[model samples]
Target: METLANLESFVRSAEQGGFSGAARRLGLTPAAISRNVAMLERNLGIRLFHRSTRKLTLTEDGERFLTAIRDNLEGLQAAIAEAGGERREPAGVLKVSLSPTFGTDHILPLLPDFLKSYPGIQIDWQFDNRQVDLVAEGFDAAIGGGFELSPGIVSRVLAPAHIIAVASPAYVAGRTLPLDPAGLGELDGIVMRSDRTGRIRQWMMRNAAGEEMAAAPKETIVVNDPAAMCRAALLGLGVTLIAVPDVLPHLESGALIRLVPKWYADAGPISVYYASRTLLPAKTRVFIDFVADHFKRQRLAERFAGSLG
Candidate 1:
């Protein structure tokens, strides 16, 4: 009979792609992980992984074994955690990825109350604009927009990710207001160069009646960060397209004004993403529910819709 430790070592090594990576996740030494895997292979009389200086790949039998035991392993671990009273009191390092501006302005404010409710949970949050590989990087969850959903990942829509044209009150004070998306070309446009594609992004603006027109800004001032673009617009540099959530405070305070109130670009949903597992950690499960509830309570979805006139 294979020991549970041997099975765990094998599974984690396969998922992480090497003994060293598995050791980091499981808090075991790489040699210990390797020994356990070797012992498991010896007992089963079959090789599990093809080892090399550069990489580790699973053998055919190993792949089949991993498929059969992966879900069961997670379930077993979850069950053990539950038996040890973890289900009643969720406790762990809750690692989450978030966009810097939105996470600071919105999600950070909710942490106090969450911490109060779950004293056992420790938060390890990474704030960055780039999309992250959740499984590869070992994140418990991520909150952002425009991430491609990879295999074994799931998302819950938190809000509409809507982009709208905005300009500072000073910039638009004497300029002729644009009637449609095509008129936006006349203004000096503050735009963003895509970090992933290295190109200036184009917006396809839509009206209330579902009419679509493309807006290609003049690209007078190019920026990378959304907040920086908003700041540039605030300095009366140019008109810029930005997400509603990123510019809501400015709009509300009269620092920035909407260029075309009826026009917006649908950028899809701002979502909370997590690994799709049969048995999620208690901390992760509660955190997801808490965030969703908070969004609903605050009417953030409506606020982020970019529908304000």
Candidate 2:
């Protein structure tokens, strides 16, 4: 019986059309690949390829053998993948990056429960305001908002985020509230830089009559940090455009009021992304599954609350 390791090298070399290419793909030296294939041939008592200085061609027997080997090999690979997907005892380090505000508002608050469930998985969490290259940083996952996602990465939308225009109670005390999105031009705006480019954020709003438009002040005070912008708005600096969850506390406390209640919009989706590589490490798969289930339960609760209202 031939060892699977030797058979794998032979199949790789045949599929890659050359030993060097297969070696590169398998992260092995060309000499090592040749040795493995030679060993496979010796064990099987057959030549799998017609070799030359400039070319390597599969023999008739090699072609037929390779076809059968290919199927078996693929089956073996799928079996391994399925086995690895079982994250019941995920035990390893899981590194993740997330937006600072979202991390503080959502992820941090729910982390204790996650730790309780999977005590085997250790987390190295980093809060970042800027976009991070997960592959380069060696992060297992990332949580972010936006419709656009990086290529070669798998993404699952956690929730539909709501963006609202809000201002402090003090700012609205003597001011005329905007009944429509068009009236936003008459108010002082505090623009927060929530995106990577540091541009002043604009409000996408719709009036009670359902007329929609994007609004921003001619003169705007731009702030980089969402927390700082929230603080400024709460202190009555100006009306700010922010995600609802970030300002939910202030809304409940009567510290801030919606400037244009009818103008709230769904700010696309908040997603958790990870590399789409075929083989996922145990810890990463565990966290992804848990996070998805957690958000599903949260959405269900939200639906119940909305029904009660």
Candidate 3:
């Protein structure tokens, strides 16, 4: 197959009627243009030019080849320019993977405004708990936490993934509020078991003053999913350790209150992941920027920090 450079050079030389003129247009030396055309001719096993000192003329085969490739060449150039992030009108199906709960709570709400601003782009968002293979699965972007970074994947931290103890007001109505993490051991725990290891999940809680302790609540109810555990907590089943985003609405609405407020379990970060930082498509880049901007503008990091309580 001929390279893009060779095809471009041959077409440019044919259009200009001389290698020197093509070279000037393409910002290449005349010798470079001639070599590219020659390489392309060899690759195609046909002579495309009748070369002379004064001018370049197309051979019979060259005329047919030029006609066939002229329109296609313009399309290829447009595609290349778009791929290089030169697209003014970004329009395409943006396939993104997101954690179900977090996606619904956080990113999904921004969709109406996002779609309003970018009417050309269509969203194909998948809400799942499992970590998706971004490049292998052909995803444009993903947002959540605990994604194992593969080669070419990059993450931008949007908020602190802090697991704070929360229980519905009805559950904790008459019960004494705990002043520390260890006091959680006395409460009925709506704990989650790891689906991967089939083991009970435990956390080491930390505070802003560098204090660390175990937050092992009584294993009264066990589930495999964080969302389930969160639901149980909200239902007034028991106190559970959950990420801030999962219960931010409830916390704000006075449905659930933080227990042992000064301590939280650090679960890395909630990040927006993509294939590359510099070579991202326009739609993906803007989405990442939009999510990050909202997170910052709303001060989600500070609000999500349980240690400050």
Candidate 4:
């Protein structure tokens, strides 16, 4: 009879295309993967892979066997995990990715209580602004806005990622307030250059009266990071459009003021993303519920809407 280790090695090697790649994914050495596959082939009396120095390709029998087992692989793993007591307690490392500013400002504050409640679970969190491949990179969950959802990934909207024009009180003190988007070009503009596109980003602003216009300010300073743009505004360098959540505290503290109170850009929904599975691990399941509840209890959806007068 073939063992689970042999089957897993075969499947992972087939998916990864090489023993070395499978080793990385399964946390086993290439020799172990090779040995397991060899043992399985010996047991079955058939070669499953066409082994080579350059790449590993499946044999005819291997392709058929993979088709039969691939659909059930995740379910089999879940069943094993449940039998090993994952369903009873969240006791494994939970890997998550999040944006630096939002995670620090909002999600980081909730960790104390979450950790207190689920002490058995360890958090491995990465802060980044780039869209990550959740399944390929092995992230348990991710949080941010404007992620393109691939197959087998799910997302729950946490809040509206709305952008609004903000400036330090001193910056706007001597300048005339912009009554419309067209008037914004007269003020010194602090803007962001896209790291991916290398072009200055523009904002499409909408007012409360259902009027829309493109606000492309004359750039005085260009930045790549959201936090740095806010800092530049704080130093009274120029007016900048920023996410409402990023500047909410400053606006409330009177450090930053909304230039056009009714105008905002609807970027998209800030979301919590995870792999779509019928049986979610307890750690991932609890974290999702906790974050959703936190947003609701704090009224972050409304506050971060950029509609506050």
Q: Name the best candidate (by TM-score).
A: 1
Clashes of each: 0, 0, 0, 0
Q: lDDT tens string, model 3, 206-303? A: 98889899989899999977788888988999999999889988999998998888788889988998875333567777888888999899999898
- The per-residue C-alpha lDDT of model 4 at residue 27 equals 53
**Candidate 2 local lDDT, 60-132, one digit each (tens):** 9899999887778767766776876664577777888988887787778878888898899887999987667
Candidate scoring better on lDDT of 1 and 3:
1
Between candidates 1 and 4, the TM-score winner: 1
Off by over 4 Å in 4: 1-5, 18-36, 78-87, 208-210, 307-309
Residue 187 CA displacement from its true place in model 2, Å: 1.8
Model 2 misplaced stretches (Cα beyond 4 Å): 1-78, 81-88, 194-198, 207-210, 218-220, 300-309
Give the Cα-based TM-score of candidate 3 against the true structure.
0.74
TM-score for predicted model 2 compared with the true structure = 0.70
Give the winner by lDDT: 3 or 4: 4
Q: Residue 206 in candidate 4 has what lDDT?
A: 91
Give candidate 3's whole-model lDDT.
0.85
Per the 3 Å backbone cut-off, how many clashing residue pairs does candidate 1 have? 0
lDDT per residue, candidate 1, 46-123, as tens digits? 999999998899999999999998888888877777687543788888999999988988899999999999999999
Score candidate 1 by TM-score against the native. Answer: 0.88
Question: Which is the better candidate, 1 or 2, if ranked by TM-score?
Answer: 1
| lDDT tens per residue, model 4, 1-309 | 677889989998997788876775555788999999999999999999998889999999999989998778777877787788634767678889999999999998999999999999898999998999886677889999999999769999999999999899999997889987778898999999999899999999997777899887789999999999999999999899999989889999999999878889999999999978766778899999999999999999999998655
- Give the whole-model CA lDDT for all candidates, comma-separated: 0.89, 0.74, 0.85, 0.89
